[model samples]
Target: MGGTNCPTCGTQLMDGGKIAGRRDPGAQDVSICRGCAEILVLTRSAQGLTLRPTSATEYLELPEDAQSLLRVAHLLVRRQQRLVRAPRQLH
Candidate 1:
């Protein structure tokens, strides 16, 4: 497996020129881009896995619970990014 770039933000979703994450991702697996919080899916090709934005229809097909989880995850990623950009000052 090789590093895949997020199609939406073009952020490199790998580390040290290799895939880096909790586990190896497979084709059709949904992922949220850290750069833009765009929901995406992995696509496999002769080269390697690539990220593509998840379509609205594809998202709707997911179970309600799964969809909710993805939304929450996206929000959390955005929140973390905001925190990193602007840390709160001590009172």
Candidate 2:
């Protein structure tokens, strides 16, 4: 994984390196758009790997555990985003 842009928000996501206990992303792997927090799926083409917005039905078809994990991950991303956007306080 090198880099890809979020299809929804066009946020450039860069993969620094492979995480522990995680395999490289392949076709149909689900991803979250860090910019808009939208659910995306990986699609491979002659050009390279890219993201596409996940359909409602496609999301519903995931296992319950997977759905739960996605929800939590989404929350975490949103929380981090909010923290970054929050104004700093001076002592």
Candidate 3:
């Protein structure tokens, strides 16, 4: 509902409806129209939600919700890495 056109295909998405999926924890899930299903990852960064295609050179900008999800994923990944590196303590 943020952008007027679909980020992947530039098609006009419906004004009001459930436009994306939320079940996936790290990734921002979007329902693409019949044509633009090639995109795979929608990541939210400091800049914004960046829609990246698995095989393409270009990226599509995402809305706020997607952006937030990407930030969460980024934080989670960092936390996991920190835990992995931290020295374990035994008593």
Candidate 4:
């Protein structure tokens, strides 16, 4: 999956607009682009998943596919967090 070039730096992105070597399978926070170093944060809850920039001051945007991936990743992290916070039964 190829990605579009960054508008600011014109860096070509690969794999759904994700930078190489910056992907994290177990990442619960934002992922930064290797070219422009833009932070991509995904948030999820019972409602659904949402992709957005981490900081308001910074104006960075990720491709649509990357945003979708972030949403899924965020959901996974939320699920894991719920499991971790669940109460254990004492036998």
Best by TM-score: 2
- List the lowest-lDDT window of 10 residues for candidate 4: 82-91
Q: What is the lDDT of every predicted structure here?
A: 0.67, 0.64, 0.41, 0.42
Order of candidate numbers by lDDT, starting with the best? 1, 2, 4, 3
lDDT of 2 by residue, 1-91 (tens): 3437776566776546421112477655777766666777776667767677777788888888877777777777777777455321111
User: How large an RMSD does model 1 have?
Assistant: 7.6
- What is residue 21's positional error in candidate 1, in angstroms? 4.2
Clashes of each: 0, 0, 0, 0
lDDT by residue (tens digit), candidate 4, 1-91: 1223333334454355333334432333455434444344434445433334355332225456865664555455445545444322211
Candidate 1 displacement at residue 82 in angstroms: 3.6
Candidate that scores best on lDDT: 1
Runs of candidate 1 with Cα error greater than 4 angstroms are 1-3, 16-22, 83-91
lDDT of 1 at 76: 79
Q: Model 2 segments beyond 4 Å from truth?
A: 1-3, 17-23, 83-91
Candidate 1 has an lDDT of 0.67
Tell me model 4's lDDT, rounded to 2 decimals. Answer: 0.42
- The per-residue C-alpha lDDT of model 3 at residue 82 equals 51
